[model samples]
Target chain A: MPRASLSPGAVVGLALRIVDEEGPDALTLSAVAGRAGVATPSLYKHVRGLAELRGLVSGRVLAELTEIAAEAVLGRSGDDALRALMDGWRSYAARHPHRYSVLVQAPLPETAEAGDRLVGVMLAALRAYGLEGSAAIHAVRCLRAVTHGFAVLEAEGAFRLAEDLDESYALLAHMVVSGLRTAREMSAADSTPGR
Target chain B: MPRASLSPGAVVGLALRIVDEEGPDALTLSAVAGRAGVATPSLYKHVRGLAELRGLVSGRVLAELTEIAAEAVLGRSGDDALRALMDGWRSYAARHPHRYSVLVQAPLPETAEAGDRLVGVMLAALRAYGLEGSAAIHAVRCLRAVTHGFAVLEAEGAFRLAEDLDESYALLAHMVVSGLRTAREMSAADSTPGR
Candidate 1:
């Protein structure tokens, strides 16, 4: 809150707080500067600009998610690892809905490494399926789609039925694991001669 | 574009055009009013406000998509129907990236019936899968997640690999259909006598 104490990290932290609490529309340079007890132009001394500040927020969110995912999938493999990863992410999204949306805009050019780290954990969970090359990439895409899409839809109140959302999510994870196993089988079948 | 010619439909059409061309940020009552050759205050007679205008856009988008999906899956069943539905949506999202996002915010309160019509087409596509009740709901959710997630991520430039995105989408469709069949088999197994 003091002038001398407002560093770049402090400015980003405040900006993130604003987005997390008041929503993204409130995340302007002026608001961040005001919250930091500095004039609007003075923010130039802290963050490079509003764009960079937003990127920093995305990077931080990605880094945090990567950490959570890495921990959740550690020492696990196959379906066990995949389910853990999805559950862990579902929890993160539920706890910080706004920040979770920020994370979705992740892997910004500046935060590419953080994005890859998160993606790596997901890819690792699929390693046991033994898909390689293009199949491997598509598997990752499929995993992300199921998890992220479900989260976004749920957040948008799209699952209006009284049926337990947890149940639906659990079933979703089950179906995806089944699908991956089937893909592995299909790939194997394709490579086999005279099946 | 004259004031006498401008109606609620005209305002929403202009608003959707703005979102489709210039992105969501450019969509405002003033922008729509200007495009309609009417003052911003005149929008009150055509639509309740910005929110209602936006909701109309979503409704129109949903109606359009529902028609496409209905046509794609007609006379098809099982995996064929599912793939048709997804491919139809992918084509829509590809052609109207911005309006596609608007469709995602859809099924807004004012657009509930339109949303249900769109959803019904999808549910009908899944009819051959034979899942009912909660499983039915979850199946729809899964289908939606895979399709919507894949679209959103692709649009966001998240799938940066050199691999063919179309192929990946095809594989995704295959995987989801396989997953649904598995769910059906599992449910059947549960209902049957001791194995």
Candidate 2:
């Protein structure tokens, strides 16, 4: 209980392991304290409370995802860039199902920067489609939903059939890209001077 | 303690209420027992245990979803049928956010009939696209992921932007249908007698 060197980073690292292994519900001050070899109250000096811990964890999770997206899309453009970013996203989700599972929840205030950066990467790749305003945003949501939805379903064993998931994922990327490819024309068509 | 007439149906009804009002995690035997005005042990006489209760709940959820999809797609075909089914899915998820949250998990054996019917409805809608075998299965997964992903994200407040979600959903349907309309060609292309 006397480990004075336990910084917030150390606390977050332990908490991440807890989240990665047992899921978000298992995270608690007592749980982290037990892992950190300290009393639950003693840990308050390092982090504010459970919410703060979760925020820190969220920040880390989003930041990591942003990095993966950036790396995957680097030197790529158009469908290739978008596909790479999505592939990185699903791979991250698959590797860390527990962490990936929490992503559906809105990021906390502390994690907004990381969250925005992640969105920025997605937007950068989506730039290839020339969609603007609402169309671009909708495309973002569609891509996110596809990857997030597919990854979560696969992790939960929802796809019970014997079909190859990898193949399905590739097909999804193709479909979404096709959808993105049309957003511009759809927008332009909507903007035309017609009744 | 002499309520020997309490049927399994009664227990499931109570469990469904708990899940609807609370969530999947809140469906413990003790909680259901509290709602049923009986001891946890007495409730066990009707339902086997927590797992069985979950299975029963899953069956109810899937059955209800199957019914919605069937009604939505009735007398419709191709994109209309597909849109109705997807709209039905997202609306059902929005209405029963708590119950919908658990659909990602594998359906317990008891829920297989309901689950299969749900898949059947989806397949029926997709029949107009003329996709079969792996291509058909992949298309199904794509649709499932879009609705599931969008619903879950929306429920969790993940879509923080100011864009209209309804419009985004419509766009998603359009994009996915466009992708599906080509699945037949994509499949045929794969089977062509070329190296």
Candidate 3:
């Protein structure tokens, strides 16, 4: 039996590359084995099955996203942190569109702790902007909706506009920033207005 | 020849039913034909192929969504209209999660006139709130993102809240209405905000 230098991480990484190059439908266990220069059984030895492999890829992608998001918010606060983190998110989506989709759809319980950590990072970042409780939760969800929708649409070429999409995204980021600012102000005013 | 009463629309409708009951991964041409009480070849007589069948399902879903959205905005204006329409969007999503997802991810033609019609319908609804041009476009996109994201996450059980999701959804709609109003007011003042 010939031993391959490839690890499970390498196999999953190559699988992601295949997905990125050929779309998710093109991802097959045999194909991943071939790409990773391993026997099909050898591939399964490390990963459980296609679903498990997909889960691994999803977890890795989510962890990467969480790290990038955390880095983006580090040393930044308020609206600036939100912008930075959101930009990090958009950039991650842009750079890894297929993997991003995988992350979006794949349910990785293993990544739940990591995802929660990422959310904590987001909540902390928004805390600088003064949104807490339901407002904070609402802000995070709204941002996720806006960012996920835009990224997925962009990936699918849904922006059939004559104008550049980048411009629209920039404007979107601005509006989101301003909206968060308003929400923060309102949150403060709830305590004491006209001070 | 054994003939069944299944038509193309019935086939697609049954396929949507299968999707709703068993999920997209469970949807297959054979399964659709089986559910429609027809032969596979007879099913093909009504549709082009699997992709076409999926496209038909997506088209019907989008058409229904357009009608519901139009109805939600009727005789309503401003925040009232926005909330009603967005609520309608969410209801559509919740009721038809599988088809809604297919609608989001399916590839439409670059010059897909159907999508244009859908967008036009949404824009008309926004116009009830006095939005025009790119603001109208942006509002539609934002609304779509929020609706799609929330629906997707909701269907996927992404939210881990102890409270009722309907409560969160109401808050979501309220927040979107607020944001849209702010965007409308700000865009109006800018006088030359570009898409």
Candidate 4:
């Protein structure tokens, strides 16, 4: 009965710990209850089910990502801001590989409010670089895809080369910055009349 | 018992069908056995187990991706080849969203022959544009990350924007091409020094 005292936050926190120690497959409502020393029904008092529990974890992860991205963009502008934000994301992912995977796993519309906050952070980081309108959105999507894809693969240990992955990541960051600058120039030129 | 006549390829094919219809979570040894019209033990004759079966499926997906990238790059070079290869990958992802996730999920060893083949395809595509050595490797990785990340998020319905994702994808492709070009140039310039 004392197990009923466990709060939703405690349950979710325990779920994350399990995931950190055992990977995503190890996460389940029953497992979380057991870890929390509570019955599955007791967990229902705070969380909906496994799906909701996972969603809760996802919300936390996204929020954390937003914080990190926002911090990375603080007092920085242009390419420097972009790099700092992206590097911050990469650092978070490297540190909490499993939790980050949850963020990437499925798109949670239920957590849209939290997710949007993260998106706002990401967009604001890009804004410091002067990208706006469709170009800004496009740049954000492109930047996200590249950063996340690289992070996921790296987490999965997909890189085969004996070379330092850090080296590759630095190159990736440089490429994204250069890519944004080039896209900015190209779009600018496209909008202008022929020389 | 008569289903004992099925080959590993047939079993894998049927398993892929289940993945297509129901996604990976629906995949189980019992389910595969039932779907294939064989007793679960009979499945052992063709595949090792659930993990092995999944591995087979994952390998098939990776090989298919390699083939598609190859087809896209054939007779193409530079931005054209890059776009073609990425478009080919996107088309495949769209057609086989579930399998695409599977390919990205299972991490393969870099030293493995299959891993080499996958990288070989992408690198060959890059070589068409004069991207060589680490620069070529970095370009291949950048292209892969953006294309893959975009496709997965698209598949997961991550975007809530009003605009068509196709337009977003097109822009993403443009960004990747421009990014790769810029990265290659920077690498070349960095290596050249005295310029």
i-RMS values of the candidates, in order?
1.9, 1.9, 2.9, 2.0
Model 2 C-alpha lDDT per residue in residues A1-195, reported as the tens digit of each score: 454568899998999899888987688899999998888998889888887888888888888888999999999999889889889988998889888766545344676678778888888898877877877888888877888899887765578899998888877887787777666565576579973
Q: Judged by TM-score, which candidate is best? A: 4
Question: Deviation in angstroms for A136 in model 3?
Answer: 2.5
**TM-score, predicted candidate 1 vs. hidden true structure:** 0.88
**DockQ rank, highest first?**
2, 1, 4, 3
How do the residues A95-181 of candidate 3 rate in per-residue lDDT, one tens digit apiece?
A: 878878776667547667767877787788778666556767877776767677777776666777775565466556655676665
Candidate 1 segments whose C-alpha is farther than 4 A from its true place: A1-4, A103-113, A184-195, B1-4, B104-108, B184-195
DockQ of each: 0.54, 0.55, 0.38, 0.52
Candidate 2 TM-score to native: 0.85
- lDDT per residue for candidate 1 within B10-101, as digits (tens), equals 77788889999987658899888788777889889879887788788888888888899999999999888998899998888888887877
Q: Candidate 1 or 4, higher DockQ?
A: 1
lDDT of 4 by residue, A154-178 (tens): 7666776767666677667776777
Question: What shift in Å separates residue A137 of candidate 4 from its native position after superposition?
Answer: 1.5
Cand. 4 Cα-lDDT = 0.77
In the predicted model 2, the residue pairs found to clash are: none
C-alpha RMSD for every candidate:
3.6, 3.7, 4.2, 3.3
DockQ, candidate 2, vs. native dimer: 0.55
Evaluation by lDDT, superior candidate among 2 and 4: 2
